[model samples]
Target chain A: MNKTTKSNFITYGMVIAAYVIMQILVGTGSVSSLLKGLLVPLCIYVVLALSLNLTVGIMGELSLGHAGFMCVGAFSSAVFSVVTVDTITNVAVRFTLAIIIGAIVAAIFGIILGIPVLRLRGDYLAIVTLAFGEIVKNFINVVYLGIDKNGFHFSMKDSVSLNMEEGSKVIINGAQGITGTPKNATFTIGIVIILISLFVILNLINSRSGRAIMAIRDNRIAAESVGINITKYKLMAFTISASIAGVAGVLYAHNLSTLTALPKNFGYNMSIMILVFVVLGGIGNMRGSIIAAVLLTLLPELLRGLNDYRMLIYAIVLIVMMLFNWSPKAREFRDKYSLKRLFSKKNAQKEEA
Target chain B: MSFISYLINGISLGSIYALIALGYTMVYGIAKMLNFAHGDIIMIGGFTLFVVMNTLGLPPLVAVLIAIAICTALGVIIEKVAYKPLRQASPLAVLITAIGVSYLLQNVALLIFGANTKLFTSVVTVPAISLAEGQINISGETTVTIIASIIIMIGLMLFIKKSKAGQAMLAVSEDKGAAELMGINVNATITLTFAIGSALAAIAGALLCSAYPTLTPYTGAMPGIKAFVAAVFGGIGSIPGAFIGGILLGIIENLSKAYISSQMADAIVFAVLIVVLLVKPTGILGKKINEKV
Candidate 1:
């Protein structure tokens, strides 16, 4: 427990330090425009990685719908921003409201999807989560929403029949998606959100409920026999994880001027990418997740000069990282370089004695 | 008449899914790994055919043979290089590695082919089958797909039931250690399973591209995932279950698209899996294994 907390502190320190350095670079005009464009996305990915790790790493359920929650958040927040754009002239206030709405909407969805899904275990849970993502993606494509003097109207057929008055606006344009969203999301907001997520996740990881969640992950049957309410705990972790992903979604939505719920952007590939972050980061390691998300998010962009070879290199990195992390030789090397051995040599010798 | 056409379309599509699901079920049954890269092999096969026939100007049949050969060899190599070392690793680790292999295949394809859809010419040429006084017509590709799949299924069944190598596959899947003790050559059996699975993927890819008439880098992704769902729905390790599940899922998806909202078809198909699993967690033909604490 002490070690865990200490590691969390170290992680927090590293993240804050990196944030400070990045901010300094940006302020001094030392950063490139390409990197500046990546800042918000980098933060969003970090949050996604952290939240996904909560369920996959701590809760031990592989959810393939983290992006679905993000989808909910993105669309919801975008809609909120659009609806209130005329009334709320202040971008900051509207953006905050958008984030809050997005998080709540996503949490509700998480509960709705999680209740039935959490009943299953392992691979079954994974497939169900995958289905949930597909359902969300497909659902968005056919849905049309508009707001008029009579209030909000929705349809599945065509966006033209949203029943809005002449002065009213179409919020969701079916497959065309929500446009003219206020791009008020800045890099600083993203960093702050990332910090807030880290703080909540870290504190939760050290809390009693967090222990219960981990206990359930370690052994579901044993945890249930010991009187841990599996449903409540699983729901807690899953919902919180979903909400955080929603927060990331809000961040992402506001970063862009137009938000679309396209399969390419919010589908299996995106979900899998987030899962890759969690898995490659050493599931359950928050610091590692943050690092992996940041590094991997930057990698493709860094390799953009190579054009087509960027993704190829990314794929190679994925394979190599997996091998290094999981292979027996790598494990032996990790053991050799472990901080415990370096820091506690006297204790180790005493134990040997 | 339209209904019959839809049914034919669904059946043809389902057969392709079944072909792919067979490989998935076989690999899962024997290797006990998800082989997430299996779908990508379908893309590789299609791309190979496109290259051989379009670029190299080879005959369609010879192009298909080359594609099958490439996929089979690639599948064996993947198992040997990526999955072999991780046999003793945790399920999560192996799953991630499988995903990595999938990413590798996709990105490699993306780099080579770009993201644009490539038009693929139909390889099989047969007369359309008309029924009900021409009210219903099944395309030549659909007819050929259904018949070829049926023949393949029968041939695979016979091989598994009557062939020595097939028995070795069964034994290995049943108990790898025990199979090794019985001199079944477990690794060889696994390599053979991957080889056969990849070959099936090649056929499925050819039929799918010809039916759809467009091949993109990600053309196999949706089908791959849907096939995985079918594999699970039928019971992950059950051959007949995968077969039945694939056809049923295909029919359900198409019928839903025709009768209900076209947009909701994919969701409805997935919903069926969820409903089925809720009632029967191990799936339709899945055997219940006791959990060890």
Candidate 2:
């Protein structure tokens, strides 16, 4: 196998081995309820980080509104699950459909937002995405929707304003959000999605479209001069990234019984947290993102014993990680003994031959 | 009458935004990086004021001065420790570090101040004025905010136009290598910029709390975001642009809240930003530089 495939295999093997070990622990009853409860969410966060990495690390664009896309996937899927719960009695088929719906809806929103936004560069693009993200969250909050024998009802004012027929089901109740969502998201499904995200992102990075996207990121002017359609490639990468994030959102919605859009959940802070994960993971390193997301997500929980010092420690770790990652002396140290360097040496020998 | 009242309120709010935007605009101009921690500096300033006036029983003026001093020192220290090392790093890296510093400041405040809100007593001593047969009464904070912002704006303009340090700042912002070659102290200028920016933030904190009358670790976050939008709206590096953007944004926000749904005011403001950016990509007064291939 080539260098790329070999590295990809290593990453996949690591995840599977980890999963098996975790399953053993879970079966043995060695894991606590708190840690066990955290499994699905941890996987969800890992997916979110990877998806964001596709944009910030590979596409060379900083997005400050990623959670908005997550929010879109969540609320849309929640609506679908609520509406279809009775008709689709099978939980697996129902969740599969909801995930598909969530992905499609999020992709549509991404395209709509991206077409206008991708025209801008750097900070402007970042801020514009932020604005659109806020718009989506705000729009969701004010929206009210329901269904009855007559038809579906919708309004922007309030749920009462939807004016559905008597005994009709209210799918969305604005701030209160959708309740009674079936928790079809299992840890097994979470792991499967993670592996799927890993497969797709890893394979795509080695493909022609992925190369085109990276080329654009490296030098937009040069890429454009070389006949790489900047607009098409940018939108394609952005849409794909958004859809992946949406899928994670689907997992998130299902993992919980009730899904609501709160600042802590779907706001800019969440986006920033995802960005932190991407950056800390050594941007563009897919395996690194997974590890970073897992570790950072666990950091706060691990520091829980310290009480007030938990967040304080988390902040220090973020800064220290940044310093260690980018500082010149640390880079030299890492390069001397890093597995990445060892792999590069093997690739160099192959190229020379 | 209500419309007139809203307009006045908008202007008052806009002035506070203007004060905050000035700091953002200046730091962006010289440092070429967004200091996300700048907003937290305002929070730090507010807590300093609280400690001084509430705990030490100091006069409001002394408390305000102490707050400014404390924030200025904190800003310089952060720049030296967290940001200076990453001067050669990627913008994204620097941005993340700034975020870390912001998080550190916030969590630290939370530890010391606790999570409960503190009621802020107004420091502005000016009396309220009634105009047009008392139909349009203006609060002391509003009058002081508008006048103070204008004065500070003019003063800053003169300082930039005439001061030697300001000249060094302009040179460094224009070209750091060239500025160093020309014997201008680039690092010192950056430190000065952060110091000035933090001082302005302290003043802004005082005024913001006086108007809103609440103190919490998260107080500066939302307003910081709005001021950032304002800085972008007016053209990030231009002082006059920040002032105009702040006022216009305030007016738009207030009018929308009054006439439109108050809950959706944030969305409307962001929509306006997107529209402006689409029309003028560099912002209202931002200069467009051609990309050198």
For lDDT, the strongest prediction is 2
Put down candidate 1 lDDT per residue, B52-125, tens digits, no spaces.
Answer: 98999999899889999999999999998888877777666677778778888988888789889999988888
* Model 1 spans with C-alpha error above 4 angstroms: A329-353
Count the clashes in each prediction: 0, 0
**Each prediction's DockQ against the real complex:** 0.57, 0.62
At residue A146, candidate 1 shows an lDDT of 92
| lDDT tens readout by residue for model 2, B198-249 | 9999999999999999999989887887888899999998899999999999
In Å, residue B167's CA in model 2 sits off its true spot by 2.0
Candidate 2, residues A97-164, lDDT tens digits: the string is 99899889989989998998899877677778888788888888887899999989998888888888
For model 2 chain B, the run of ten residues with the poorest summed lDDT: B89-98
Q: Per-model TM-score of chain A alone?
A: 0.91, 0.91
Single out the weakest 10-residue window by summed lDDT for candidate 1 chain B.
Answer: B87-96
Clashing pairs in 1: none
Find the candidate with the highest DockQ and give its number: 2
Q: Total backbone clashes of model 2?
A: 0
Write the residue-wise lDDT of candidate 1 on A103-187 in tens digits: 9999999999888889988767887888988888888988899988899999998977776779888889888889998888888
